[model samples]
Target chain A: MTQIYNFSAGPAVLPKEVLQQAAAEMLDWHGSGMSVMEMSHRGAEFMSILETALADLRELLAVPDNYKILFMQGGALAENAIIPMNLVGRKPQPATIDFVHTGSWTAKSINEAKKYANVRIAAAAPDGRFHAVPKRAGWNLHRDAAYLHVCTNETIDGVEYHFNPDAGDVPIVADMSSHILSRVIDVAKYGVIFAGAQKNIGPAGLTIVIVREDLLGHALPCCPSAFDWKIVAEHGSMYNTPPTYAIYIAGLVFQWLKRQGGVAAMEQRNIAKASLLYDYLDASAFYRNEIAKDSRSRMNVPFFLRDESLNEAFLVGAKAHGLLQLKGHKSVGGMRASLYNAMPIEGVQALVDYLKEFEQKYG
Target chain B: MTQIYNFSAGPAVLPKEVLQQAAAEMLDWHGSGMSVMEMSHRGAEFMSILETALADLRELLAVPDNYKILFMQGGALAENAIIPMNLVGRKPQPATIDFVHTGSWTAKSINEAKKYANVRIAAAAPDGRFHAVPKRAGWNLHRDAAYLHVCTNETIDGVEYHFNPDAGDVPIVADMSSHILSRVIDVAKYGVIFAGAQKNIGPAGLTIVIVREDLLGHALPCCPSAFDWKIVAEHGSMYNTPPTYAIYIAGLVFQWLKRQGGVAAMEQRNIAKASLLYDYLDASAFYRNEIAKDSRSRMNVPFFLRDESLNEAFLVGAKAHGLLQLKGHKSVGGMRASLYNAMPIEGVQALVDYLKEFEQKYG
Candidate 1:
């Protein structure tokens, strides 16, 4: 079989060792005589898995003691509405939610919030293109806004926030879906941080929400009991039947992250991997990545071919060389290579070599 | 290696073959060089898995063409809130919804729906105990009810509906989480059928919603877009990233069901399994099942030891014999042996033999 490297944006590549361990334990977990999938979520076996996962994730991110980690379903897309429902209740009726519309994800968040609150676009990309994060200085934040929502890493547009914006006394709700565990950050800086687990975490079904303790228990009357963060935190995320198998896989990934010396080590490797590919793309005239240097994402790198007609041939040759899912998102018709933490430097090098070869063949 | 039988209520046992196949494909699915967990939901490879699973499920259930199958997250508990949000919009503001509260599951649904609509208990067990389903003849369903909700099989109460309730022009929305696909039923009779995939289906985190076409677009303004049935059906459950891995396992289970001669054959096996266990409980003075004979669930059998002191010893002996997770739910403390579609008759026989042995040793 040919060597393969996957580059799908979310539900992307995972550590091979993690997959192997999951496969090995698929039938019976640690002599329990039941597969992890077969164990009841309330059982000791699955409880241990859930606790360990939560602990490892907290330690890796250095989450403050005041923050609660919640394991939820429906991903970030659902959280778009859940956030407003849970947070807007703390403010007055017809609460205004401040949003920094950096890219596609924030746009979705802003639109979903409109159903629950009066949404204010605090700042947006001046060019109407998602190539850069709008400057924080220009943001027209509302003093009485419920919360400031931002997509710290725009998965589709390949834009990222390198620094945390100061929101004064207001809380910051950041959607860190794509670049969550790929780097280390101060967990205390944000009022709430949420990510769909498919990208840098585990599977698509599981979502991780980290919110401060003070942010609990103000959900609107319409909030689903299961999605109410306070109720979920109080029950240790078992208020409803959680995604047990997905949580188990995520626990395994957390263990894998620890074995690799935790998130800091993974971040260094991610940076090196992203640098290798970005450097090659910058030096090549045949390929161009249009995003500003400082704003570009280390996790997802979307680029275009100088001659657009060679796009299909470039993808065909890339696949022949065992590079897979390199096509950009439909919203942006180009090529994208995601350098998530699980992606090794060798995969990046192979793709760089392929890029050089493809440009030479079609120049 | 003990020959173990898992009797977990939810996050329950799956077919051995399904687990083995999933293990084999954990690293790479069908030579795609990516685990199903690692594939994008929009990509062809994952799409194929989703489509095949949906098709297999439709075939096995004989779902009508007018009904749309939606793959969602948050389990049946979340669906408790989601159901009212999607249905109550059909009627005017302060819509009245009717419910047949036979057991714990329906009680929970009634409480959740009260958040969105005015809930009326159309019929309930005359006695407070959940021993039997309320007969349809006694139902005082509202003529203008948005829908009448029923729990076909209450996992905790072990009460099963042996006959479909007639609601006239009012639609019947059944929560078939624990007994779906174990028997044949006419799909056209109900407006919506929802089940959490942890009982008769696959793992938790994936919920299946089968709704008639006319029930699709009545979502309330506050309904989360990801859980909106109309939006989900339009995008084929890809409006938000689905629980992809769970769906894949469910598909495998569907295939396993097909190989076992579909739901009709499973119904025969289930009848035999339930009969063997129920007969033993009835004949033995040491054991008793409280559920009415006509309403006893074929999937979940909750029984009690006449001498409650021997409960610990019975469980210990059962575990020693590899009959695992036989403890009853906390709400009803005794024992529950869930004989889902994946459980073979041999496992039931083993449990029966153990019950006899335990009774003889301590009677």
Candidate 2:
């Protein structure tokens, strides 16, 4: 069988070791005679898995003690509404939320927030091309805004914010769905950091929400109890039956991350892997990543072929050569290479080699 | 090690063969060169898995051609809010939703519905100590109700509706989270049958919403697109990631169900298992199942010991004997033996044996 590299933006590749370990323990986890999926969330076995996963994730990100880690569902798309519903209640009725729209994800946050609050576009990249993250000085942030929303990494447009933008005393709410744990960040710098656990984490359906303690307990009346951040934190994300199997797999991935020397080590490798593809794309005439170099995401690299007609042939040949899911999102037609932390440099190198071979044949 | 019998209400036991298969394919599914978790939701491999799973589920339940099977997230707790958000839009402002409050789960649903619409308790078994399902003929359902809701199986209160209630022309929405797939049902009878695939299905996080085609597009303005049944059905449940790993496991479980001679065969075994445990409890002075016999849930049998003081000791001994999670919900404060389809007659026999042993020692 040909060695394959999956470049799916989300629901993307995972560490082979994690998958192997999961498979090995499917019938009986260790000698417990139960699959992790079959274990009760409140059982000692699953509780230990959940605790270790939370602890490892905290350590890997150097998260502050003041922050609470919540394992949630509905993904970042759902968090778009949940964040505003939970945060806007801290202020008066119809609270205003400041949003710096870098790309599709931030725009989604803005749209969903409109359901619960008044949303002001604090800053936006010109013309919706999502080429770069607007500078902090360019932002028109509201001084008393309930929160400042930003998509730290736009998976579709391939843009990332390298530095946390300070929006005065207003808390910064980041949609870190794509790039979470692929690199390190000061947890205290943001009021809430939420990521859908697909890329750089574990699987779809499990969402990780890290919120500062102060942000707890201010949910709008309409917010469902299961989604109320304070309630979730208090119940340890078990107010409802959480995504248990997803959590277990995430724990396994966290363990894998730790084995690879934690997030810092993974971050270094992510940087190297991403650079290999981006550098290659920059040098190739047939391919071009449109995003500004400074804002290009370390996790997702969306690029277009010089000749648009070659898209299908390019993907077809790439797939035959053991490259998979290189197709960009339908909303953004092209190619996207998502090199998350689980993606080794070798996979990226294989993709780069395939890209070159394809270009040499069809450029 | 003693063979443990897991009686968890949910996040419950799944088919052993399904777990074994899942474990075997953890690293690479059918040599597709990627874990199901690693495949893109849009990729051919995952798409094939998703399609087959959906088709098998539809066939197993005999779901009508008009009803779309939507793989969703956030569990039934979230669906309480989502249901009204989608259905209430069909009526005017403050649309009244009638609910048959049989037990804890339905009560929770009623509470959540107040946020989206005016909810009426058309029928409740509060006076019956939540031990009986309100007879269908007794329910005073609102003629103008947008939908009538019911928790067909209450995991907490050990109550199950043996018959579907007539909701007039008003759409019937059923939360069959615990006992879904344990027995076959006519899908066309209800406007929607939603179940979180944690109990008789596969895992938590994967909520299956089977909605009739006509009921798809009436989402209220406040509804999140990800939770909007219309958007979800239109997108084939790929509007969001749809909990990939959980869905894969569910597919495996659906296949396992077929191998076990489908729902009819499983239902027979379930009847035998429930009868064994219930009969033993009735005969023993030490243990008592207080739920009305007609309303007793085949899936969850919540019982109390005649001597309440022995509760702690009972649980301790049960654990020592490898009887796990027999402790009932905190609210109920006793014991619950959840015998979902995956739980064998042998497990129930073991529980009955233990009950007799305890009775011999203490009766």
Candidate 3:
């Protein structure tokens, strides 16, 4: 069988070891005679799993003690509404939320925020092309905005923020859905950091939200009790039955991360993997990566075929070579290779070889 | 090894065949060279899984073509808020919602509804004890109520509604979290039926919401786009990333259910399994089931030992015999044997044997 590498933007590749461990323990987790799916969320076994996951995640991100880690559902898209429902209540009626509209995800967040608060675009990608992140110096941030929202990495646009923006006194809320654990981050710099676990963490259903303790308890009157961060934090994310099996899988991923020397080690590998592909794309005229070099995402690399007519053939040949899901998001209409933490250097090299072969065939 | 029977209320037992199939496909699903977890929610592989699961669910429930099945998250608890958010917009401001206060689950739903609409208790379990479902004939229902809410099966209280309430022109919404798919039902009767997939469907993170087509597009401005039935149905639950792997496992369960002669056959088995334990409890002086016989849940049977002092010893002995997760919910201090569709009749007989032995030694 050919070695396969998956490059889905989210719900992407996971550590091979993690998948193997989960398969081995699928029926009887450590001889408990029950799959993790069968265990009660409140049971001692699952509680340990949850606690260990939380502890390891906190350690991996170097999260500050003041930040409360919440294991939530509905992914980051749901959090778009949930965040405002929890935060905007802290301000007066019709609170204004400042947003840096980097790309699709941030735009979705902004649109969702409009349902809850007055949204202000503090900055947007220049010329409306989502090829680069706008510099923070040009942002017209509001002094009294409830929070400043940014998508640190845009999966569709292949843009990322390399520097943390100084948001003055307003809290900086980041949608790090696509690039969270691929690198080490300063957790204290942002007031709230949320990511869908499917990308760099674990699976699709579980979402990780790290919010500063002071942000607790100001939920809008209509915020669902289950989604109210204060309520979630008070009950330790068990206010409602959590995504238990997803959390178990995430715990295994965290353990795997530690074994691979944590986020710092994973970051170096990701950097190398991303660079290998980006360098190849930059050198070849047959393929063109549109994003500004400075803003290109290390996790998601979106590029286009120079000829445009070879898109289908390119995908066909790529799949034949065991490079799967290389198709870019439909919204983008190109090709995207997501080198998430679990995507190996060998996979990147294999993709590079395919890129070269495709170019040679039709250059 | 002793055979194990898990009786957890929500994150409960699943079909052993489903678990085994999921393990077999953990690395690569159907030659796709990607685990279900690694596939994009929008990919062809996951789309097939989602469509097949939906079709099977519709067939099992005999769902009408006018109903839209949505794969959602945040469980039924979150739907307590999402329901009101989506439905109340159909009525005038401060619209009233009627609820039959049956048990703990309905109480939570009523509380969450208070955040969005005027909640009126149309009926309550007579005597304020959750021992029986309130007779629908006595309900003080409102003519203009937005929707009538009921918990079809109360996991913690062990109360189940045997007959569907006739709401006249008012649409009925049910939380069938713990007992969905355990029996055949008329799908056209309810305006919405939502269940967290942990109990009888699949895993914890995936939520199944079957809503009438007309129920879409009336979402309040405050409803999250991801939770809006209209947006979700339009996108086939791809508006946000569905819990892909959980949905795949659910697809496997649906296939397994079909092989077991569909829900009708499972319903008969469930009836037999519940009768085995309930009949033993009624005949034995050492045991008692608090729920009214008519209101007793065939899926979750909560019972108390005659002597309260022996509670800890009873649980210990049950665990020793591989009767796992029999401890009842904290709100109800007793033991619960949940005979979900996945639980075999043999597992119920094992519990009954344990009950007889325990009574002989401690009666």
Candidate 4:
């Protein structure tokens, strides 16, 4: 097989070792003569896998005792609506939810949350381009808001929050889809933290939501029981048949993360990789990354060629060089290289190498 | 490895050929050097996989040209709420959705649907036992009901609707979770037929919803955009990142089904498998199956030992004989052998042989 680097923003690249093990076990998981896909969710084999995955995730994120980790479906987009449906009932009818509109994901959360509650934009990034997160001083926090919503990392816009926004008594709900396990954080800081398990986790179907126990049990009557955090938490994420195979793969990833010395060590590698690619883009006049320096995402690095006409040629050449999925989100219309936890620094070096050579030819 | 036969109700057995091909392609799918899990849902590689799976499924079901197939998440359980959220808007406010209370799944749908609209039980099975589908003559469907809901296969109760009930102009929404591809059905008969992919399709987390084009755009305000049929159809099920790996596996299953001469041939094998097991249970005084014969599910056969105390021993002995997941649902305890499309006739024979041997020792 060719040495390939996949740069798709999401449903993105996974560890090769994980795929190898999954392939080896696909026909007969643990000599059971049944694929993990064939195991019942309530059965002993799958229960153990689910439990281990949950425990390992807890250990990796240092999730507080009060937090419940829910493995759900429908991705982050569903959760935009699901979150408000589950949380708004904590207050009286027609509650208000505060949001800091950082980029596409948060803007979406605002729109979906509107259907369930009165959505109030506490802050918005100054430019329409979403180049940075607004400073906390400028936020107009609501006194009795149901909860504050934020997208800690925007996959498409490549803006990330380096500092946790303080909401005081108002609980913060963060969408960490693009950068969940790439670095360490204080899990206790937020009331609910969710990540669609595509970019930094395992697969596209599974969404992981970590919520404080107190935050459970307030879902509105309109909330679907499957997505009601209270119901999902009570059932240990098995209110419905979960994405079992995806959970299995995520379990494999959690195991791999542990083998690589957990989140702390992985964070160091992510920093190095992100810095290498960003540094090259910074030094080169041929390409530019627009996000504010401190707000730039370490996971998804979206950039543009100084000569815009070369975009198509750049992607085609990148593919021939065994680099793939380099086209940025259509919403952004440029190039993006996602250096998820699964992406090695070697892949970064290759991307940076490609960038330099392309500049030399087309600058 | 032992020659195992898996009878898990959902997340049940899948065709061995599908698993083999999945394993073979896990690392470098079609020489792309990317596992299907790692491919973007929007990229050409995974899109092709999704398109082929949709095309194959459409062909196998002989789906009408007027219907749109949606690949979603949350299983049939979530669809209980999602279906109402999407369809109730088709009727006036405070719309009534009539349902045939057949078994556990239908009961769940009734409860979930009540959150969005008025739910009326059009008919019940006459008893709490759910032994059969109530005949159409007993149905008291609301004159202006939004839709008629039915669980075509009651997985837990082992009751199935072998005949489709006419709902007139009221669109019939069928939950075919546990028996989707195990037999052939006229797709145009139901307005929407949704199945959780774990049983006869591929893996868990992926739900297939076949809906008529006319039923596309009436989603309620609370409906998550990701779960709205119109939005999902418009985006080709990519409104959000889909369950890519499960879709790939499902695609493989569809191809395998085609190779085995499609649904008609599979249905013949299914009938043979169901008869072989049912015949033995019928002739024996030591065993009994409670579901009415005409309504008995060809997929999940729930049976009981005359000596109820021997249940544990029977399960242990069956496990020793490499027949797995024969234990019935916790709600309806005894034993159930789910012979999905993946279960070859030999596996069914093995189960019957085991049953005979166990009866000989304990009868």
**Which candidate has the top score in TM-score?**
1
Candidate 3 C-alpha lDDT tens digits along A32-81: 89999998999998998899999999998899899999999999999999
Residue A212, model 3: lDDT of 99
Q: What digit string (tens of lDDT, one per residue) describes model 4 on residues B20-45?
A: 88889999999999999999888788
**Recovered native contacts, candidate 2:** 0.78
Candidate 2 has a DockQ of 0.74
The worst-scoring run of ten residues by lDDT in candidate 3 chain A lies at: A160-169
Q: Candidate 1 DockQ category?
A: high
Between prediction 2 and prediction 3, the one with superior DockQ is 3
| Pairs with backbone N, CA or C atoms under 3 Å apart (clashes), candidate 2 | none
Predicted candidate 1 versus true structure: per-residue lDDT over A1-363, tens digit per residue: 799998889889999999999999999999998888899999899999999999999999999999999999999999999999999999989899999999999989988999999998899989899888888789998889999999999999999998887688899999999999888888888999999999998988999999999999999999999999999999999999999989998888888999999988988898899899999999999999989988989999999998999999999988898899999999998999998988889999999999988878777
The deviation in Å at residue B280 for candidate 1 is 0.6
Q: Please list all clashing residue pairs in model 4, or write none if there are none.
A: none
Q: fnat, candidate 4?
A: 0.92
Q: Candidate 1's residue-wise lDDT over B266-359, tens digit each?
A: 9999999999999999999999999999999999999999989888998999999999999999999999999999998999999999998887
Cα deviation at B349, candidate 4, in Å, is 0.5
TM-score of 4: 0.99
lDDT of 2 by residue, A1-363 (tens): 898888888798888887877788887887777788888888888889889989988888999899999999999888888898899988988799999989888877888889988989988987867899998888998888999998999998899998878888999998898988888788888999999998878889999999999999998877878899988999999988889878988988888888899878888898899889888989988899888888889989899999999999998888898888889888889998898887778889898888888888887
Among all windows of ten consecutive residues in candidate 3 chain B, which has the lowest summed lDDT? B1-10
Q: Tell me the deviation in Å of residue A244 in model 3.
A: 0.9
TM-score per candidate, in order?
0.99, 0.96, 0.99, 0.99
**Which regions of candidate 4 deviate over 4 angstroms?**
none
lDDT of 3 by residue, B1-363 (tens): 689999888688888998888899899899988888998888888889999999999999899999999999999889999999999999998999999998999999999999999999999976888999888779999899999998999988999989977798898999999999998888888999999998888889998999999888998988899999999999999998988888888899999999999999999998899999999999998999988888999998989987889999999999999999998888898888888888999999999999999999988
In lDDT terms, how accurate is model 1? 0.93
lDDT of 1 at B360: 80
